[model samples]
Target chain A: MLALDIKHLNKKYEHFQLKDVSFQLEKGYIMGFIGANGAGKTTTIKSILNLIHKDSGEIYILGKEMLEHELELKQEIGSAFGDINFYTRNKIKTLTNVIKKFYRNWNDDAYYNYLKRFNLNENKKIAELSTGMKVKYSLAIALSHGAKLLILDEPTSGLDPVARDNLLDIFQELVEDGEISILFSTHITTDLEKCADYITFIDNGQIINSSEKEEFIDTYRLVNGKEEQMDSIKDQLIAYKKNSFGFTGLIHTKDFDPSWDIKSALPNLEEIMIYFSKKENLHV
Target chain B: MYNLLMKELKLGVNPFFYIMPFLTGALMLIPSWLYFLVLLYFCFLTIPNMFAGYKTQNDLIFTSMLPVTKKDIVKAKVSVIVILELMHILIAMIYGMISVRLYPNLIYLFFKPSFGFWGLCFVMIAIFNLIFISMYYKTAYKYGAATVVSITATILFAGCAEWLGIQNSFVSNLFKGAGTEHLTTHLFILIAGIMIFAIFTIIAYRIAIKRFEKVEI
Candidate 1:
């Protein structure tokens, strides 16, 4: 059974609409969700988590309908969002104690271990904690819950580079367990390169592309050419934006011409995002 | 539910909220404590402080992301308010009981030194909760607007209570009168107070949960 399955999910606001979003995360792979701000990435996740009511669609977690099994389903899912709001009055010890009661698989020892690992004090109030510290606290609780899936929204947004790398490493370790999966939403492309098996890009409330991480990297090629070269090969261009002197185009690697001098190119997720978002106007 | 309740106590609201009522209620003792209605003034301080964290722009997005459901979230908030209201009344009542002991000649202004004053307090809190919770939940996106609406409703409550006290009809009977040296509370009024509390709390919860479900974040 799939760990998560969302089909034809729709939600609308005054300015944004998540139009029939759907995707699945199997039991053992990580899905990176890339989107610009206001792109409905968080909305789609909220629907899957049953945090928001869907106007229409079906979502199943561990093969059980989400609406019918929210409490049970939630027990196995670890969730974090970019905006971390905690009770400012609560000491870290109290927060841990409170979360311990909700999950039967909760490990107090594990939670405390992480507190030490992260060098966080149990007596610190949540309001006094830094953004990076809050993220670590949320993660410590999430990981100790024995959850099978983690739905993290921009979990590393405010962290230092060393801290961010540590989080990515944790995700890598979690995936190796193979019983767990993650749907990580963030602007950090480098993190995706480290652990993502697949990617789905959302822009302006739409999903532009969904594919394996390796394939997403390999599918698009950047070629620099003058106007005449651009003219000769214009039909093959998957995406193109012109500079004053010449045109730079992203061609489908599958359709690339060996005879053409494509010039120097280094492939990466950031370049691909630029190419596609410009290509389809969210074409990624 | 208990887990989330504990979390609410710790992080959702400030400890000062709980302590402020006690401090304010203690102050009433200094003013001959004959001013039983002064407790209403104490309730005023709570509304803004109670909702201080939530009145910000990001609160909607932030609160919705927690493990608790929107329903539970609404319940927790209302519960916190109830706890505060209860704290104020109880502390005031305790001080009321002590004031009478300290100054034997003290006259019971609203209710006699007995069950009547406590009952009045209950009804007052019930009324305030219904109006405050309902208004806040509906106009939640507009924190300034909702605060103003609820504050207006509170003032209206104070005005209406004062009007009833002077006329001394159905409202006068609820609080202790001059004829009754020892105040008494009927079973029905207490029950009605609780029932009203339940109904309004449910209404507020429903409104908030529905609105929360539709929030974009």
Candidate 2:
């Protein structure tokens, strides 16, 4: 079943405009959204959630149009942001009760189970909780609500190393249920590398590229060579960064000669991000 | 609707907002002569506090993301305003009864306070709520200008009432001969005042819901 489909969504502001931004994610698969801070990641997500008005185009979640089926569409989906998404005056118990009123499928047992696991006290006011605790509570709430699709924007942000790892584990577990899918956005590429099966890279309000994770990682290779070797390779390169020591470029792994000692060292998503960023800089 | 209303109450009913009504209502202990003064004071000061809790938390964007509809959000906020207004009226009326008991034959200096006066307070609050909700929902995401507009509209309502009282035509006729002897006219005035309060409150709800439906977050 289709989880989300954003088609030609358009919105404009004074300094920036989202022009025909579109992508899709299927059920039971995690799609990692990668972008720069001002690259319109939040804008696109806001449009889908209907938090911001869009100039044109259509969005469908679980095969229902957002405008007509707003309440129904929202009921099936859960969302969280990098910042804790609740009022500070609320105690966790009050927050849970409020959420339970809106979600028909709210599972109190699951909520309590998550709180126990996360070491969250139900009576603690949100303002008094630590940042990490707040995020933990937010995720716990999201997971407990029987949400078929989880739309998280930078959920791992501001979390310590241990918390980040624990969250990644929860994400994997959530997907393991096969009924849940995550559309996770993050600058922490390492997190996505571990759990994402698909990726869609956005740049300056446009989708620059998208593909399955295995094929995406396999399609590009870091080619280290001198000027002589570089002269022989230009069109075969998709992205590159160079220094006086030598030039390094990303080439389709299939194009490299088999006779060379070209080891297939797994490139970190950061390396891939730098390549894309530099490529955009070159255009400017 | 209850979900949305509860969310607003949770966020809107902090120490500052919850206590503000009691504190302001206590001012009614001054004199029956100053009752309109107290009510007018309340209509301006209390309504702005509705958005104060929202300011402290910076919660508008976060609140909009939940499954609650935008219309429900506006309704919840207006409900809080009404709640605070009622809290003010109830407490002030209790103080009013105390003043009457302490001085049974005292003639009010400005206009004798009565049930009619308390009912008029509700009308005052309801009108301000209508203007504030209708105006605020249009440009609510805009923090500065929307607040200024709403607050300005609130103050203007008080100004218009003051202008009416200068001649004692509209407000005075309602309280005519309300001094030494109690009158059922005060009862009619109270009932008419309540009807006006209900009508304007309904108008505010209608306008707020329509505006909220089109609000972009």
Error of 2 at A183 (Å): 0.8
lDDT of 1 by residue, B107-166 (tens): 444444445445555666666666666666664555455556655665666566656766
Task: Give the alpha-carbon lDDT of every model.
Answer: 0.71, 0.74
Calculate DockQ per candidate and list them.
0.34, 0.51
TM-score of chain B of each: 0.78, 0.81
Q: In model 1, what is the error at residue A227, expressed in angstroms?
A: 1.2
Best candidate (score: TM-score):
2
Chain A TM-score compared with the true chain A, each model in order: 0.89, 0.90
